[model samples]
Target: MKIPFSLPVIDADVIAEMHDTLTNTGWLTSGPKVQALEKELELFIGGGNALCVNSWTSGAMLVLRWFGVGPGDEVIIPSYTYSATALCVMNLGATPVMVDVKEDLTIDANKMRMAVTSKTKAVIPVDLGGYPCDYDAIKEVVNAPEIKELFISDNEKQEMLGRILILSDSAHSLGATYKGVPCGLVSDVTVFSFHSVKNITTGEGGGIVVNLPEPFDNAKELAFLRVLSLNGQNKSAFEKNQIGGWKYDIIDQGLKINMPDLCATVGLAQIRKYKNELLPDRKKIYNYYVDALSSYNWAIIPPFKEGSTESSYHLFLLRISDISEEQRDEMIRVISEKEVGVNVHYIPMPMLTLFKNKGYKMADYPVTYDLYKNEISLPVYNGLTEEKLHFVVDTVVAAYKTISGN
Candidate 1:
């Protein structure tokens, strides 16, 4: 038996909803189903307006572009994140300023505060492995009078925001919280990836939660992003079909990244169950891992909960003390040989060729490097059986022993 790192929840409701969508709904691409999903997510996020996009990259790009992030601008991001966090910045012709992370694997808010310059338009705090970054600290940094004074507004949105926009890279933390506030409402804006590997999925889709402050209407911003995702067309095909609605205007040169109704159906089914079922289930698995590994001398348990912040329990990131990167890799190899699959959360951004060529170095980010060198992400998904869980725990311990020659 093999255990994969992640799997999407596709239950009877998902299939039923998807079937109804394929046959019942007259539309497929970005219609009422997608609208329903947006509304549900909006409510799920507590107060923010949620916009469904084709992917996390597209949603993030749309938000960045809307904020006028372009040439000569810098978007600060943690080096310990998936490439999407940085790629979205590069796509907008803005520079992604690499920063080290805290032990929690979240961006260090103070480091970001120090990294700010006149060119700094945004600071993307990545909730890597579902653990939220220090939002209150970041809020203080962005809201400081001096920091606000340093902000150079390039557009109406920027001028309204008056400081660095906290666009959270929350791809792994949709249901997570920072100080009891949900991930969606924790930042100026939060983008959630509904990928196949995520806790909640829409096959390949994303949700952009808008929580921008006053003078910036979130509802209006939602409308703008919705149109922006639909190739700048103020009206969708469904709307165009209505009487005297054929006349539509191209607001701007926008992207075609709207989530389809077909995909939205799956997301809708998943989101409804997330709070009551999915999230809690993942938490159970997370607790079990911690309880099992706590007694071991070599086991360095990942930060699942630190103070008020709580994870979505997306990835069970386990670390081993006093191990080289080679030894860590060997552990994964040995574990996989036992048919227990595992993975590493990330290779720091500076270690990648794309950022390395841009003069960013891994040595510059000691904290990110320290965590990355020994981290191993274990499987945490729905339907992982008790026997499989036991097998996984045993397999990891056995692999560690093999690597250490113990």
Candidate 2:
């Protein structure tokens, strides 16, 4: 039986919604469905204003750009995350300072605090594999007087945070929580991905959640981001469709990255079933793997539930204890040969050619390197059955033993 790493969960309801959206909605790009999705997400998350976008990359870019993180400014990020976390900073002419993450794969708060300088404009803590970073601890560090004094404020956004902006790279953690609060509400700003591999999908989409506390108006921030998402147009296509609303103004030189109604259709459908079916099913599969693999002393299962926060159970980041990098690769190969697919979450940014050429050294981040060497992301999706879950665990255990010559 061939069990692939991950698959999108789409049922008849999703298909029917997309069909209805296409057939009924005349204003396709950023129309009623998109507006409805924004509202629905806001309600689902319990607070914060939601802005849907074409991708998490673009949503992050918008946040950095809005915060005036540009030329000579430094944005700190975990070295273990996808390159987009660093690349977004680079695209804005800002420098990305790669930092090490903790054993749990979240960004280290102490390292993050120490990394802050007068030039540091923001710090993006990635929720890798749908597990939230320790936002409470990170917040205390951000709020520290010493760190607060180093902030260089040039805009309203910078003024509000009073220090480095904590923009959460929550691409893997939409339904997650941190300290009992929803993922979106924990950070000053949070970005979530709705890509096909994610727990919820719009084929390809993302969302920005504004948690910037009042005195800072979230609605105004949402409007500003909407302008930035649509090539700086004062009015969107849907707005312009209104009678005598054709005339509009170009406010800022923004890029085009708004989520269309077609994507929103899927998002709307998915959000409805997310809590009741999607999350619960994924949790079951995650537990199944945990139960099946618990006896293996070599297996280091990821923590989905810790304290009050719970992961969305998106990716199962399993690590092989005492296994060398070479042996881990061989294990993956053997598992694939047996028709059980396996994959890695990431290769550290400093190890990548792009960031390496830019003068980053992997040697600086020992923990990130160690985590990457043995980490494997197992398949955990909505449609995965108990049988496939058991098969995957059995295959992985056998492959590891075989590769280790045990």
Candidate 3:
């Protein structure tokens, strides 16, 4: 039996809705479906304005651009995160200061604080493997007096200038919670991915949730920025159909990154069915893996903190104890041979050629390297049947035993 690593859950309802949306609506790009999806997402994630985009990378770029994080600015990010996290900063001609990860594989808040300087503008903390980072701790460090003094020269301006924005990469944690507050509301700006492989599928889509500090008309600002980000157009395709609304302006040079209605149609259906219908299945598979793999002395299960009831359960990352990177790779190969699909979460950013060429050193991010060497992402999707789940778990155990020569 072949057990796939990840499979998206799509139902007849989703297909029917998508077909109706495509057939009934002539305007596919940024139409009623997109608007409806955004509104529904806002309600689902509690209160905060959401701007749907073509991809999470584009959303991150737009957020960074909106915050005036450009040339000569630096954004601190975890070394263990996806390349897009740092790529967004580099794309803006800003420096990406890679920091170490904690034992749990989230960004090290202390190291993040240490990485801050006069040029430091924001910190992008990733919810690695759907585990929530200590946002309160990160906020405290970002708001420290000493750190503030270094960034803000004037005592009066310290409050405003010294503050570092928390741009959460919540691509893996759409339904996750931190101390009763949803992930969308926990950060200054949170970006979520709706890729085919994500907990929620929209084929390939993402959105940005803005939780602004002041009452700056976030809805209006987000709407305008989204329009500008897509094509620098003053009016969207929807607005063009309005009587005498075709006349619009191009404010700034921007990229084409708007989410289409087709994608939004799928997203809307997923949001409605996610919590009650899909999440439980994912949790069941995760619990089964945890229970089956617990007895292995070499396996370290993913962390689940107390009171985190709404975890997205995006990936089940397991760490191998006392194993070299080569042995870990070999273990994954062995698992594949057994027809159990397993993959590594990521390689540290510094190890990549692009980052290494930019003078990023792997030696500076020891903790992230340690985690990367031992980590393997197991299958945990909504459609895993009982037979497939058992096969995956048993195959994992067998691979570990074979690699350890037990």
Candidate 4:
């Protein structure tokens, strides 16, 4: 009766696809199936060019590197997110200026504006726990004429600098929506994770979706950048096979982060089931959790902002109001003892040892810290049967009552 936080729901189709990929002719890397998955992701997530990568971390790093974010530049990110969100910025030798999160656990747009300075090159807003951030608010902050001018030396340079990019860490929100537009379309550049726990499964894969303004050929630029990111090779496995195209050039220094066709096959199967099949099942579990916990005054349910109907429902993050961090830990322990495994969504990035050693003060982000202290991620994947779902909910209620002395 052990219910884990999140588990990949795979079946015969996923196994069959993977087996077929293993038996297929092309298997080196980035073959026809990889390209096809990229195209399908682009179409599935609406208008944007999708580039498959080995991981979302690589996708974020590639996008930042392609956009000229480097040493002496600063990228603003929420303190309340997985380390990968900030690690990508650090990987480029750039600074990650941590910002606070609002009560809803998404980055606070106003704080993001205050964190901007001459060195600030981009703003990365994370869709924490599958909830879409206020994209319009973030865009307005990044697109402000005053903010744009601050990054450049003069009006002439301002025009040359281009608008500050909104690179979204949409790892948790592939199917999420904001104001009728999909989450992937909300930011200038969005990266989605297809890890075992994400809405879709690619074994271990991710994709980058870009939406840029004119004067920038994001698709072509990103395509070349993807090549550079993979190995700096002029041609991928698919391209090298073309008649007389075997020999290619190594254009720039790059990292090895290309998705194989075997992974893409799993992605293809998962993507097909995402819209019509898997999503509804997740939504059902989410509603059940909400309905079961509706009467608890201490429960602060995850927000599904108004006008946002297409959430991936990746994780159900429940915040225990007025609870200390120690109590939260104890509650998790109690739940685990009952065989209903629960976990925390994340610890604030600033609280991590690396950031703390680098002089990132956690007290600066009180709201973000508050959310981190109380947050608990409940089980909400496709594998949960109706009986197990109810058992998880009941265990949570029992744990809360025991911990709070209610």
Q: What is the C-alpha RMSD of each candidate to the true structure, in Å?
A: 1.1, 1.1, 2.3, 2.1
Encode model 4's per-residue lDDT on 1-406: one tens digit a residue.
8777777867888888777777865465678778888888888877898889889999899888877788888999999999999999999999999999998778899999999998888899999878889888998887889987777432332244476778999999988888788878888889999887898878798998877776657777677777776688878867778788899888988878889887888888788778888888898899888888878888888886566455678888998999999999999999999888788889887788999999999999999888889889998888788899889888988998999889
Winner by TM-score between candidate 3 and candidate 1: 1
The candidate with the higher lDDT, 1 or 4, is 1
lDDT of each: 0.90, 0.90, 0.85, 0.84
For all predicted structures, in order, the TM-scores are 0.98, 0.98, 0.95, 0.96
Taking all chains together, the TM-score of candidate 2 against the true structure is 0.98
lDDT of 2 by residue, 184-233 (tens): 99989999999988988888899999888667888898899999899999
**Candidates sorted by lDDT, best first:** 1, 2, 3, 4
**What is the C-alpha local distance difference test score of candidate 1?**
0.90
lDDT of candidate 3 over 254-355, digit per residue (tens): 778999998898888888877787877788888888888898888898875557534678889999999999999999999999888888989888898998
Candidate 1 segments whose C-alpha is farther than 4 A from its true place: none
Mark the regions of model 3 whose C-alpha exceeds 4 Å error after superposition. 152-162
What TM-score, to 2 decimals, does candidate 3 have?
Answer: 0.95
Q: TM-score of model 1 relative to the true fold?
A: 0.98
